[model samples]
Target chain A: MNNSSSVIEPKTRPIRKSKIDYSQGPAPVSVNPAWCKACNICVALCPQGVLEPDAEGKPVVAHADNCIQCGACWAHCPDFAITSNYK
Target chain B: MSIAAKEAGARQDSDVVLRYLRPHVKFPNMWCPGCGNGVVATSLIRAIDKLGIPRDNVVLVSGIGCSSRMPVYLDFQALHTTHGRALAFATGVKFSRPDLKVIVITGDGDCLSIGGNHLIHACRRNIDITTILINNYIYGMTGGQTSPTTPAGAHATTTPFGNTEKQFEACDLARGAGASFIARTTVYHTTQMDRLIMEAIQHRGFSLVEVISNCHTYYGRLNRVGQATQLLRMFQEKASTQPKDPNMVDEDSKDMIQTGIIHRDTEKTELCDEYQKLTDSLAKGKSS
Candidate 1:
């Protein structure tokens, strides 16, 4: 039941945001907090554990340096919540 | 901006789920908390996106089941037919308009149990239709009843004593019934699943890709798998791609479930090809 529309906002910044480096390369990733169901499937499937749950349970880039951008998170996300520019 | 530049802009940043999913699809999918169905659906759309085919060229058809709910979200020419009739309808659609790329999405119970006959015959005909059969091992939509593919000793509401029946070997059934391409993949292996679906789409004849998905809400709880993530972890641990005898599928053993292209016979002429040949011969005879 904790989805985008029905869930209320904190009136501040969404903790989970993208650090997308598409202009440069495929190493960095981003999270669309509104689209994320907070299922954490991307978190669980990440081989590097590069992402971790934020306060609202949405996945945030916990270790941006560790992200290999193999696209496990991007492909496995059912909600289209995470975007990775893995060339 | 020009159309090409606009398309490139969307591609430069949008996640694949956003790039491929129908804009009108509901915010949250109806599947359970961590259902593997979403992963499979994303894998499929990603495959279509990779193939460079226009969305208008694709037709997604499905029978009733949790996995079949995919068409409602996919932006394609879709037909959500009655329960157990997807393949039959897809066969007609593919035959009547062979130019369209037809893909049938069905679940364990929908395709293997009630729609078993259509599946077998479709394979036998070697029709040019790709079947992405999502096997969650139990009927997730109808309250998690034991399905034909449920492994022995697995628990379901209908099989509280644990399932006594043998599980159905999906790829083997298709191989025997004459599917030209047979492959298997899992939601855990996202990349591989995407590649397999693409190959299935490209294959000239009947193709079947058995996606080993999880029903965490029911099959997992009753069978003692902790949650969707735990079940996926189990897949990561249990799946094996090493070359094993294709004939060996020991359901009783804890061996990694085989994941890859298990069978492909391209020499066999596809049904449409044969039909075209027949028409050609008739036309030649008339001219003579």
Candidate 2:
């Protein structure tokens, strides 16, 4: 309220969010959900960050594009849920 | 005479110069066409070249297998020993002539199935030698029999219903057996294979490099995979790098892992170093 309040404050702007494109993600390899036990062994062994956990802790191929197709996941899996299709 | 004229004359006469170029042993190579044994042999040669060890100071040993014929093709001092005894012979050679660089070339069945005891003891003792295990999944020389490394549920001559026994991971076994330097590479990855073999030879302690090779005639036919290229394609498709956390692996996608160096540790004391230390102390005591 004083007469010395002539200084103006700097304006603060809100940060903008960038749009994400799901189409750019990895292609999904065929998964036999029926055979899956949700053990998540493939999730931990994937060198590429292509897999993620779902709400029930089941493995979900979140980034299939990152898969290099080394058969460690297939060889290590006790149950055969994941199968790769050679393009 | 001008310098260029002298150099040209020397180059022209170089072919006539006496050079000790001879086969280590005669070779009517037993390996089949498109087999990965050639690649493994090339890697071993490149390793020997890089080390620059005198030909007389190196002894190449091999057991009976398709890949075992490597020593026959090399120019170094060599021994084509009995089946499943290459490691045992190599151990004797290393201990007897500690000055020599000893190398053992063997296949999956030859090394893991029969020579496994020798291999474990060699690793346990940490002998100053390099061992290359060419894992081709089937016993190629013996008509496609099941090997210790044949994948579970995979067909073999002995296991027509598919192999029920679990396959042994060679690198893991070597690591567990106390091999100082352990690496795994496939024949398809020649660049990495050459580099890894060279590094293994240069390493002071016991080193083991598991070379996953293809046995087209036997293993391929038994497995219903027609050709070497198909098997190589499978390797390219199935192998992947190790994950950051083994626990974060997907349950569904368990077949994709790449081929590369899996483990390497340079800090451990070599077996020969320990032996020297013990001998030195004993000599000091005796002198006193």
DockQ of each: 0.27, 0.01
Compose the digit string of candidate 1's lDDT tens values, residues B154-176.
89999999999999999889999
State the lDDT of candidate 2 residue by residue for B1-288, as single tens digits.
553464454332212101222434333244553467755665565456656677788888999988887666667788999989999999888887888989889999999999889889998888888998999898988789999999888898899989999998888888899988888877766667778888888888899988888886777777787555466666766666564345656743454434666667788887767888999999999999
lDDT of 1 by residue, A49-83 (tens): 67777777788887776664567777777776677
Report the first chain's TM-score for all candidates. 0.66, 0.61
Task: Tell the DockQ for candidate 2.
Answer: 0.01
Best by TM-score: 1
What's the TM-score of each model vs. the native? Answer: 0.86, 0.68
Evaluate model 1 with DockQ and give the value: 0.27
How does residue B203 of candidate 2 score in lDDT? 86
